[model samples]
Target: MYKIAPRISQLTVRQVEQFRSASAWVNPSRSRTESGPEASIDAEKLFINPEVQQLLVELTGMDLEGKVFRARRTTMQQRSHFALMTDERLSETMDKMRREAQRFLSFIPLKEPRSEEVTILSKDDDIKAFDNSKFVFTDITFDATDQDRTVVVREVDGTLRTATPEEHDRMNRVYYEKPNRPVFPPPVFKDPYLQDALARKEHEFVLDWACWFYEPDDPAYVNLVQCVCDRTVDNNDFEVLHSTRHFATLVFYLALNGNIPPLLNYFGGQGRIRDCANLVRLQKRLLPNWRFAISTSDTDLKIVTDFVKQNSRFHEALKDLIAFLKDGVILSRASPKVGSSFSAKAVPKVHISSLLISAFYS
Candidate 1:
């Protein structure tokens, strides 16, 4: 007869309790039902089974005694083996599924997201050809917080992740860097004297050049001239005599030709004639030919008046000049002797008006 050690029995009891706890078997009803002779027989079989005894000792450091529990021993081994096999099979299945998924992905043609479609619509379509063969893989990581959230795309490296903003910025910088290509240079003034004269507010020189360069048909030249005119106006000291003279000459020629496009285009709009009427007075002294032609006759006066009305602010000056001519005051001041050369004859200051009339007729 074998003597059952009390310590070994107590260890077995602890092992049973531990297994019950791990399996969550706290049913009071089951415990009550199993307290009978049937339960005692089941307990005796579990202690006597060699496999159950080995498993108990290995798993829980407990030894079985007395009779073998064959039914309980078989049940426990089946439960543990089923759990282990199920986990192993699941892991293998997942790995095989992942490989198959990758193979299928390789066969199917992949495309960039449609949001990239507009990149091809640009003028240079040849630079935007799509090639699916060099497709690279990427992953996104998301971080969560109540106040702020961020998502980043990164290339996969085993299990570690890194941001791609620096790479993106570098690519963009390279793509947009200035291209090394030739472009046409702006037109430059060829005349050294004229260029040097225009370097200051040489209004007379500019006026003369404008008169020579005024081509209504060539838009490019006109635009270039206008740019120079604007630059002269901006850089020249307006109060200086040369600056004022240049402005005066510009107005005089603009009025004489009745071609106001350059003035209108340069100044951005039609301006009051009176604003430059003082220029007319100055032109009378400096460009007598211009004044002689403009103030010569009623027709010439009409031309001047029309230009003044269209583009001048000096309405009072125009009215006064028209009134003076009409009243014969200007004619009396310019009384000329017949058959006299304009320069050699002793012509009265009063004859200046007659000279003006003759110049208009000529």
Candidate 2:
């Protein structure tokens, strides 16, 4: 299958939230219903598969031991501040990245934002205005969320719980999902058609945050998401969408707020945070045909060109990053997510990715 193909960002607010809100609690080793308690091994189908883990490792060299490190490059502010060196600097770069990841794990596990970190765009006393005309708009500000969003949690004994008012405030303020994004179904299969499509034209990337549920061949059982996309961009070209079920990232701030817990998705939340971090990937790369973004506004391309032109080093670095991401997916297609053994290893500093770009994977 073509790892990355032409794409169009066009899913609605509810649609994106549905994926975020999807609660699949099935333990493959156990016979529990989606509602019952599951053993600590069933993956969320999209985010916990072996294929997904391998992809994460290849792309970021991540060990998937979320005890730390997703903090550095996953946030908007942190992302805008990153720059890569030539391969010659790879060692030094990796060293610096290791320190950052360690700090993320040892000192500051991604936590909820301080009161000073959040800025309310609207006045609290007066109103609530939203756009529902098209795309079920929930957030007007870029990457921001509706003021009244709530959070759900999986309790200690395997029962699902809605956060109390205090927890809700913290949850909503951090890694909250918004409707400003447009989603598209990209063709992820490595087939002659995709090869042909790419040979004809290169693809544009807009990295978006996502978590996969099933391996490539599994039916995946999430009929809600399937039905929604089938209505818009279904043509048996779902290479990207399927992989999304398993790729996880910091979904908001530079902190580890709502990121999907690797094992929770796999083991059904053994007192782990439901969604893991607060960093958002633009969730852009998850969407397709991002080149259209430049067509509508050259500003996007100009920003990239300017950044790339800063030096040959940066230009080359960007190219290498893209190539690595593209190659990672291609490599992953061959090692389906099924055979991975949940029993595993937790590691030291080396888990940091040589690529510090946003943990943004397609």
Candidate 3:
């Protein structure tokens, strides 16, 4: 039924011991209120975006353009804000979204049915993976409506059943009782059924993470957060606590206010251009059509583009070769003659952001 038992836990006994001794491992950037420091990825400052201005006009027929943050709140204020985007039609505040998400989580149908509209949450995967005691998991809800449309999942041969009143109480504790919840740190299977049920559905509609999630207790919490992240075989990887928060942030923005944009599609943490060549082959196996992309940072961009551009020249038969991410980005492709097809083209990242805005507003 399985190739091997997945590592019992992402943390070995040694890793947990390391955290117990350290008073506090400082994040180099400082500004660590919680959830580690804020993400300093790319040109994320989109306050003065011309594209966003244009988008507001085209969609709302109003001059409602400027920094996306509320007029009352400052940019720094918005940095820690989880529900960063809003509209009257969608959630208007972080608390509102959290309530909606918690309500959704609390929903357990009276009768479970097996239909695409309903997902049987995977129930046999690693246990205790998502039992973190910080940050509410209520991030974003896709095309969410003012309805109580809840969801659940099950094992291959399991039956879906309704949650009793007591069961609901227990589930709430698991989902919301963060500070009070204790991680026994061992063979104790505190909540096996709950963890499996939360394993991302086979074709789950949304993959979200609590931007404010940071467990102060687990000293080595950062790595533990990454370990608990769901890596679905269906390609719905929720890699929060690291290099992929941008994807979730984008979803929060677009789906709530404007048309949902195509995801920037992370091809997993290929280690910041450490494996540019191998990335091409892996991406080919995963996603072939969405070939163009921006990597974690400019250093990553260089590693990938530099290799591909040089490889193109070695062919001798192929000349006038151009790399795709020269402007600072990384990409992978499969070419018959090139062996590992990769490219880079100088693009004003503003243009990349602009184009992404265009696609969504369109």
Which candidate leads in lDDT?
1
Candidate 2 ranges with C-alpha deviation above 4 Å:
1-23, 27-91, 98-362
The TM-score measured for candidate 1 stands at 0.19
RMSD of each: 49.1, 23.8, 21.2
lDDT per residue for candidate 1 within 300-356, as digits (tens), equals 334443444443443342443433333322211111122222211221222225544
Tens digit of per-residue lDDT, candidate 2, span 1-362: 02211111222233333332212223122221222222232123334434443333232222322323323343364433566769869777777766665333221111111121111112222222232221111223465443334233333333333333334433443444334322222343223544443333211111221112111212221322222233212221212222231223221110111111221122111111111111111211221222213233333323333222332332332343233222321112221122322232222222224443232231
TM-score for model 2?
A: 0.20
Q: How accurate locally is residue 98 in candidate 2, as Cα lDDT from 0 to 100?
A: 67
TM-score of each model, paired residue for residue: 0.19, 0.20, 0.21
lDDT (10s digit) by residue, model 3, range 1-362:
12211221222334323333221222223221123322331112231234432322222211111211214323464444334444763545545644444333321111111111222222444543443332111212564221211222232344232232223223444444555343223221123532442342211211222112222222233332222332221222322211222222222222222111112123212122233333332222222232334354545434344333433323221121212221333343332121343454343332233332232223
Q: For candidate 3, what is the lDDT?
A: 0.28
Winning model by TM-score: 3
Model 3 TM-score is 0.21
Model 3 spans > 4 angstroms off: 1-198, 201-214, 217-220, 230-304, 307-362
Q: How badly does each model clash, as a count of residue pairs?
A: 24, 57, 11
